[model samples]
Target: MLEKLRKLANILYWAATAVLIALPIAALGYLLAETPNPNRASALFPHIDIIASPTGLAFWSAFSAGALSFLLFIGFLWSLRGLFDFYRKGQILTLHAAGAILRLGKWLIALALVRFMTLPTQTLLLTSNNPDGHRQLAISISDHEVGFLLAAGLLTLIGWAMNEAVRISDENKAFV
Candidate 1:
């Protein structure tokens, strides 16, 4: 079981590393493309109708929002990578590993919050190119965000439990 866990951790560490490298490049490519992919645009601004192609101020505003989201994801991945590294090193029960898990949970919450807050701004920006009457500012909180928050909360609780476990183990060792 220990060996299998270590092997899985090594795989996760590399997967996280690969994503850390690929995410930015993919975002860059998406942003620099001559025409935004329709599906991606829809996914980005689900509540708004992008009647006209984003350009100038609208483009930059949407770009900034996307970049911020990408950065948050990168932070989350970095924390995950750190946790995986600790597991790979057979240090899963250490305070440092628990801290890394806490950090990952925190990062997830931050990401969810930012995404929640930015949805309206991103929609407004993406639709700013539409005719005056067609432009929109839409606010939405989807199940995805709610589920993300729940997961983050659960992970944070687990981290706290792990910390307590470590403390108890140390106390027991001292007593012995």
Candidate 2:
């Protein structure tokens, strides 16, 4: 069972590494293919003459939000690699594993926070160009964010327990 899990961890580690390599390339592709429309309505302004301009505030806002999200996802994958490495070594009860879990949880929390912030930001950026003044300031908690937070909490607790178990096991070893 441990060997199987170790194999799985190894597979996941390589998969994440591959994604880390691919993510930037994909984002660059999206940016290059992005076409800005100038005639779009604007709530922030009567008319945004720079819609056709890639350097415009509207363009940058969308681009920046997207890049921020992509970077956060990359952070998650990077953090996960640390945790998975231990699983691959069958050292799940080690301090390193616990630390990796903590790091991974932090990234999960950060990702959720980014998701929370991005919604309103994207709404404002996209609708700032709306001339109808009907721009939405949308904000809501989605199931995905909730799930991420829950997973983070569970992993943290598991890591803590693993650490305790390892400490007890080490004490037993010393007694022998």
Candidate 3:
């Protein structure tokens, strides 16, 4: 039963990752193919312009950033797989496993934080104009993105903590 559950989790994680990766790639491809309007905001803010020429530098930068983000996302998914495996095997109830899980959790949290931090700068660069009323709106939208990211991060952290508690409880039971 546990093995089945682990496999399900892994599949779900990969599916989510693939969808997330596809979104950016599709947008990037569209930007490369179409000349964006320099005076207008892109549908995907901070990543591609709807009317601006896709410069070599911008293309490479976006590619690299996307690659890095994909790698990080993979790492998180793998860690999650491991954590799920441990839980399924009842190892999560042990102290040793708990410590390892906490470490992995911390890394995941850090990744989320890094992602959240970059979003604002990315948004500002993508949407801000040197002189316009749109700057404030851009900032506002950025703030909303940041808020959503933080909320998601917090939820993830809470789940990790709950797992930690379960591990600790299991360890205590074994000791007793």
Candidate 4:
């Protein structure tokens, strides 16, 4: 069972590493593409009825938001990769693994926060080209943000428990 887990962890570690490399490339392609992706625009500016085509400041605003969010997600993946590395080495219960998990949770919360702030800003920027009356200030809080917060809280608790377990295990070894 232990060997199986180690092999699985090894596979996952490589998978995460691959994604960690691919994500930035994908984001760069998306940003540099001559034509805006309509589906992507719709997803990003869900509340806006009119999405001004990507041009000038509007394009920069969207680009910055997308890049920043992708960076945060990459950080999250790095943390996850750390945990997988630990598991691959049969160090799942170590402090390092717990710290990695805690960091993962923090990254998730950070990504969520960035997303919250960017949504309104992106909406304003994307629609800035519109006539004065047509401009919008949209605020959206989808289920995704709520879920991220909830998952962060859960991971935090688990990290705390892992710390306690490590401490207790150490004490047991000392007592023996």
Clashes of 4: 0
Stretches of candidate 3 off by over 4 Å are 1-47, 100-104, 117-176
Off by over 4 Å in 1: 35-47, 51-58, 128-132
Worst 10 contiguous positions by lDDT, candidate 2: 44-53
Clashing pairs in 4: none
Best lDDT goes to which candidate?
A: 1
Candidate 1 — which pairs collide?
Answer: none
- Kindly list the per-residue Cα lDDT of model 4 for residues 95-138, writing each as its tens digit: 88888887887888888888888878877777776676877777
- The local distance difference test score of model 4 is 0.80
Number of the candidate with higher TM-score, 3 or 4: 4
Q: What is the per-residue lDDT of model 2 for residues 1-176, given as tens digits with 9 covering 90 to 100?
A: 99999999999989888888898888677556754343332322343222322325765675577568778888888888877888999987787887778777777777778878876776667666555656556787879889988897787777677778778888999999
CA lDDT scores, all candidates in order? 0.83, 0.71, 0.55, 0.80
Q: Give lDDT tens digits, candidate 3, residues 45-99.
A: 4443324433444434434444565567666656655665565565545554455
lDDT of 4 at 86: 97
Worst 10 residues of 1 by lDDT: 34-43
* Model 4 bad stretches (over 4 Å): 35-59
**What does the lDDT read for residue 175 in candidate 4?**
100
| Pairs that collide, model 2 | 41-129, 41-130, 42-129, 42-130, 42-131, 43-130
Measured by TM-score, how close is model 2 to the native structure?
Answer: 0.76
